[model samples]
Target chain A: MAVAAVRRLAATAPVPVFVARGGGTGLLPVELAFDARLRLVVSPRHATVLVAAGRFPGPLGVAVDRVHDQLPAPRGTLWWTADVDGDRPAALRDASVVTDADPVGSVVALHRDLCLGRIRSDAAVLADDPPNRFEGRGDHGQGGEGMMGGVPWGRPMAMTGDDRDGLALDRLPVVLGPFLPGFPNGLRVHAVLQGDVVQEAKLEVLDLGSGPRLDRLDPAAGGAQHDLRWLAEALRLAGLGALAVRAARLARAAPAPASRAALARLVRRSGLPAAWSGVGVIDGEDARARLVRRLDPSAPEGRSPGPSLERVAEVLVGQDWSDAVVTICSFDLPTDRAEAVIEAQA
Target chain B: MTAQAEVWAAPLLTAGVLAAGAYVVAVLDAAVAAAVSGAGIGRSVLAGPLRRAALLVVQQPSATERPDAASWALAPALYAGLAAAGLAVIPWSASFSVADVEAGIVLWGTVESLAIVAIFLHGWSANTHQSLLAAYRFLAAGLSYLLLSMFVLIAAAIPAESLQLSRIVESQHGLWNVVRQPLGLPLFAVVALGSSTWGPLNLADGDDLSGGTTADVSGRPRLVWSGARAAMLTSFSAMAATVFLGGWQGPVLPGPAWVVLKTLVVLAALVASGHLFARVRTERFVTVCWLVLLPLAFLDLVIAGVEAL
Candidate 1:
């Protein structure tokens, strides 16, 4: 009878969870532990909302009072799952504040590949804010009017789910170490003197296809405009702050070969836009491919061009047969052709 | 004796006494070596598989159904009796051995078989199942190698056609039998080991039967009997090395010293292997001797016999 009561108390919970404590014991503590544990384990999505708002682990009496008092005032559904039992401890309910709508666009997995990081023609930036819950109320099990601890319009991260297999997915492979992809992805030139001292050095970042590349300066010594913050961070991480300064000073009359080599490898691999241009035919069956021919004559006009290049057929300039067209050049095709090009380019 | 005969006889007598003394000393030396070997083996128990497995196999050479105590004494008695019988034909320079029989060759051959009895005692005397098993194995292996070893003697005998060791050595006034019959040395080695009991075969201590067959028997009796058994084995190996490995033929070292050194070397190697290496299963040990070594020994005898002709 006691075991049945504990299980019944656990069932009064808002969430449905099935568990068996098969540690060679009776069922009493298992039911009680589940009850105490769930109080803290209240849905993580709900906790995320509270955590993001910086309002979690509120004092039990105060939160209870606030809920009871606020219950009279009508509000959209909001909930707080708390355990007041003095006998048992609990795992905290997860909480997160999801603020922001995910923008829709082509999902580019970055630095996914060295060459992919080299694709610099199209750049997209997105901005987002938190989503607000509608019909919020304090108690969910009490049938307090609307969805609680959930983004009304946006989705939240899932901490646990009804795995189709009904088994916890704990058998994840351990990641032994961290990996760094393309930190330096493209080329840059630094002018130097006889002794290898850099008098002035300019870093050039360009789109792979068109022109309007970014040019930044790498000062040998610290000056007002020097971009040493990132270099300083690198030096601090590498334990070479003094050496960085010495090499920087040495770079003026003659850049230290060590510094130059390090800089060269970084600049060469750096993701810097090279050039940008838009060339294409206005209308055609393969408009993007026709455009691709104009931008990169090496692609050859004789063969059927892929979609991204086919869109811009109107201004096909003498056919780009060099095949030197960068991935961006293909991406830069008009929207319709861009999709076709991406499909067939690879 | 002629002055020329005296020249050889003088050294031969001196060598004979020294060789017998060394035979005694080496028997003690082998006992000390076996004890040291046993210690090393004990030290390796945790570090190796043999001690655990052998110990598990038998305790004091144990088994549910025990063999009679007489079976255990049988092999050692045979080893002693056969070794003594072989000693009977040696002649000892001009006159020292028990009986200088005319058919010394066949007489020596007959005594050599006593080693088979000695080997059987090596295993059987343990009175434990494993020891008995080892005894059985020793028998089978000895039978296989014994035939081949005798061929070597036969090969050495052909030039003189005399069974006596003295006559065989005499026929080699200008050249030893080995110069004529080279296979005698290797064949002798195989047969000597098979019969040595202390060799890889008898594993008389139940090389694989930890503690050993007589591991339980201790005090004066174990000491006396074990010492005698060891001496018997050492004696046979010494004789074989003396007979086939060019008994005392080397530059600088006196004939007696050379003979002693060669004998001890063969004896030391035998005891060391007995104490150190694990015992092979009975059937496998015999199969190897019969199928592999026995044929080779017989073939060598045929070749040496032919070459002697």
Candidate 2:
């Protein structure tokens, strides 16, 4: 009886959906914003329904499995692609699969079924393994050495490094997202951080299929929507959810003068421009300038294109995590085209 | 009722009230936030928090590899406990209060300080890069707000010549501190929001860190941590009512009713301000809080002190 009661309550809550963007799904953001039932979360740790949208290459298949295992028990996965379930677990083979053209609707339906107890959640795929095995190598499993040189728990302690402000601090190396919330889809960076400032950043590009040809589809309207999407994402990153939501709505309703004006007013009132003014620049335009240009319909033909991956790493090296995100989101990158360029160059 | 029984009963009663009030204010905050953001409101908004509570109750608690489980598990409960303890010094009415200590202002300040410690522990115990970064950010940014709040609290206490919250309320019989020290209320609101890590001041849980300290926390732990945050907001708004807006003192309504009403208004303001402004970066926020807000707070104190003299 208690279990049944809990399930009933859980079903009513918004579906915490972690969207795994594969290739370039242009409609995913618009679909996510259109539905109030779905809450697009950043981490798998906080999500229950994993929506794997678009086509994933062989390597990204492994990345999907890792993220799937990271979800807490009583979780589900919805594959929004053709035969993508080839790599998914057998338990999730049938009921959890959604090959529907409308991925968003399928996700909502799956969430509803899970909540109603119509389907049981998928079990953990990976074993409950500790991060590192303790072999009793030394006292307290320090690999026989004391604090100075031992690998504690199979990972080396962060060594001290000079920060941007000239202080020596422990530099923590972390990967900042292919799936991180508030970041460009499929963009990952291996960064060494000392006290929130990135000491070094190396771009890691996973070859997902071809990116969206946004310019080929109604370039003027598409460009406007793209700018709105950027603005919305930046606002969301800045912790302005309502404005982000409104901006996203305007993006969906692009080319409307009233909506454009409303979005512009929202941006100004949010103080986002002033807050982001001091961050590093892209193509001589800071985040504020990029945001302002995005809001203005007559500003330019093409949105200020994002810097190349190498240039991004260079610009991101000395910036704090917040500034890095703002800087990255400021520029519009044709990632699919860029990948093709790199292939040709090589 | 006997004095001993009353003493025990008062705290229990206040605790019950605060717990219930916390949930109500949380729901109201969600509704207002959703409405402003152009999301669904009305009954759906009310149902959102309840459903979240239910989901969290049934979900499993997760931990990162080799986390300090003891401290990590203890942090949320400790945060909520401190918020509850802070409520004891607030007078619901002249006769109805949990514990009206002589140094009530000091006690409340101590609670705020300890709440920060609890938050830092929550972040540190997670043993993840994001959580640790959030912990350090709070430590750096929280200091400026903490100092600013202390100065403003002292300013409110000056005219009353008392640290007792009830006395402070009594001191505002002629003119509330909102008028006496014009900058006191706004400055206090900013500090209250900053200390609680709500809205624009929510750097510890900002999108940059992907929910920051609470990134890895889920299920019941997330519920409790979030609840404690709402409770702390309630406690601060209640204190602000007593210190500046004249708590429980009103024309038509009874004392406790007035206190409740004023607290709700202050809470609404805090919630609205959180959604109104974009979150400033931590480094920039710290600079603004010290260079700009700190001096204004001191000026408010100086004026209050002179008035008392």
**Which candidate number would show the highest DockQ if scored against the true structure?**
2
- Least accurate stretch of 10 residues (summed lDDT) in model 2 chain B? B31-40
Candidate 1 chain B weakest lDDT stretch, 10 residues: B51-60
Best by TM-score: 2
Please tell me what DockQ candidate 1 reaches: 0.01
**Candidate 2: tens digits of C-alpha lDDT, residues A252-303:** 6654787677767877887888888867676677778867777776665436
Candidate 2 runs further than 4 Å off: A82-95, A99-101, A127-156, A164-168, A211-220, A300-302, A336-346, B1-8
Task: Return the interface RMSD of the candidates, in order shown, one decimal each.
Answer: 36.1, 1.6
RMSD (Cα, Å) of model 1: 34.8
lDDT of 2 at A19: 74
DockQ for every model, please.
0.01, 0.64
**Minimal lDDT window, size 10, model 2 chain A:** A211-220
lDDT of 1 at B72: 53
**TM-score of each candidate structure, all chains considered together:** 0.37, 0.92
Give per-residue CA lDDT, model 1, range B1-309, as digits (tens): 597896676456534543454345434443543243122223322222221122112211222124456755454455555655665454433334445577887876776676666556655554433344335445655677677767677767777677776666556555655556666766676565555444344444431232233433432233334545555555566566546655555568766566567767766666555433323434455567678766766666677667656
